[model samples]
Target: MRSTVADVMTTEVASVGEDAGYKEIVSTLLERGVSALPVLDGENRVVGVVSEEDLLHKVEFENDTSARAYWPPMRARLRARLSGAGALAERADEKAAGRTAAHLMSTPAVTVAPAALVIEAARLMERRGVKRLPVVDGTGALVGVVSRRDLLRVFSRSDSDIAAAVEDQVAEVSRWDRGEINAVVEDGVVTLSGPVRRRSVAHALAGAVCGVEGVVAVTNNLDWEIDDVAPYPQMGV
Candidate 1:
């Protein structure tokens, strides 16, 4: 029988309330060495998974669009009048205080049942490009978390596997992997040959490359390895 998530999931989980303070949430995450925590409702059911990414996004989006973040979506002219010359205030101030974790958590969250197979879980993660999934019960209570990092735990990981791979070797004439052969065309077609757990990951990566300035198409030769992942190049081009 195929192993289920319960066979590998961490039963001793740390969670936070939906209304938890950002300071406390972050501190708990760091203390537990966890990237995310379940946001619970009053009944202690899973509402969403709050990740470091979610928290950082608040700071990041505000930094990227500094003006509206400080001032509450007022008219551009009014904003310009409030802050000096529309340069986004250029400094942090009292105006940017109301944002909280509740403001950042993704709701109506996507989740997986603890009885699911790893392949099914991987497919969903690849489809969504999500690093973690909350394991829940039928009533949507958080049971455990399955992170991309958790997937790596089944096998004893090594430093050599940390870097992403943009290339790989595939069967000579028996290209059995699903989806098109991973390839990119710009000045020329860049064929990708390697293992990929899901067709979605391959397509997502190759699609980005295909959209480049001079790219035309992508060919695929990606494979699936149940035991490990080959990290790919971070630079899309």
Candidate 2:
């Protein structure tokens, strides 16, 4: 079975309220040894995320005034190069002068459901450029948090377990007898060796095994009776 967010997430997450002061938020993050905290509303629903990057705006723009050093046009150009411009820069300036989580948080947090696959969570983290994600329930209330380390726990499965899973996948995908094909797993790497009726079937089995949870890599060594992928001889008129 595929691993889900619920299987690997940390349920005891450290969070803060929207009205939490900047110092309080920083204390919570330092005490918990976490880089970010979810900012919740009165109903305990996540409304935004307050992270180190958000707080750093204060330090980055501490010396700047309402009328920043750069002129509007130059600031616009800098915005394009720095990935923060126009209204975004304005928001940063506001954050620099802010004291509460509500003023400093990045809103519309990227959250995932409990049933999400580990791979899905990993992809979301990469796409969002976040180190972690808050796992929310149907009501949009915070439930747990999943991090890059959590998703990697899947690879901790025992080699024996991975081998068994690979064998099962091979059986289900190719329907070949146990004696016909075999799997060897070491350190999450799978090596398939044996013979199949066609090259396509061998390739399919390899791919299926690759999808098995905890499989780090797959090595295909199945000899095939037919090379179906090879270009067919051109027909002569």
Candidate 3:
């Protein structure tokens, strides 16, 4: 079975109020050793996220009189000039002028539900280019935080534990003969080898094994008697 976000998330998350000062935000990050923090409202509901990149933009833009001053290289400066990088820097400078989390944060934070699968959370983080995600409830209150490290916890399961789960969950649920299928797990990789009655059964068995928690990868070595997926032959009229 798939592990949910709540199963692997850290409940004690470091967050900041919308009115938190820039210095306070930086202090919190240093104290917690985290790269980002969720910005919360008066009622403690997440509104946005403030990351190191967001805070650094201020320093980068405020110190440079011209984009070229920071960009340095002529070719890179030329590229920035052509690509509207100057406008982006100007906006960053404007943001830097603000002194609170409300002005520095990236709004409409990409969040995940507590009940979401770990794989789903990983996919969201990958797609959004984020290193962590805030786990929220239905009311959008932050309950926990999930990091890239949390998603990798599954791989730490012992081989014996994975083998037992595969036998009890995957093999039994597929309804294939338990004796016919042998599940061998090595370093979290499961190999399902045996014989099934049909091609669909073989595929289903493989899928079931893959869905089991702690399964890093699945190898299907099942032999099938019939190809149910094969198309019927056309009759010559």
**Which one wins on TM-score?**
2
- What's the TM for model 3? 0.84
Stronger candidate by TM-score (2 vs 3): 2
lDDT of each: 0.61, 0.90, 0.87
Candidate 2 error regions (>4 Å) = 65-84, 173-179, 230-237
lDDT of 3 by residue, 1-237 (tens): 678999999999999999999999999999999999999998878999999988997787675667534545788767877899966766687677778999999889999999999999999999999999999999999999999999999878898988888888554745644337778899888888777778787788788888888888999898878888767778993
Instruction: Please provide, for model 2 over 1-237, each residue's C-alpha lDDT reduced to its tens digit, 9 standing for 90 to 100.
Output: 999999999999999999999999999999999999999999989999999999999999876665576666776677665875466777888898889999999999999999999999999999999999999999999999999999999999999999888877777755653338889999999999988888888888888899999999999999888788767779892
Name model 1 segments beyond 4 Å from true: 61-66, 69-99, 153-237
Per-candidate clash tally? 14, 0, 0
Ranking by lDDT: 2, 3, 1
Candidate 3 lDDT at 13 equals 98
Ranking by TM-score: 2, 3, 1
Tens digit per residue, CA lDDT, model 1, 107-151: 667788999976678788999878778899888887887877666
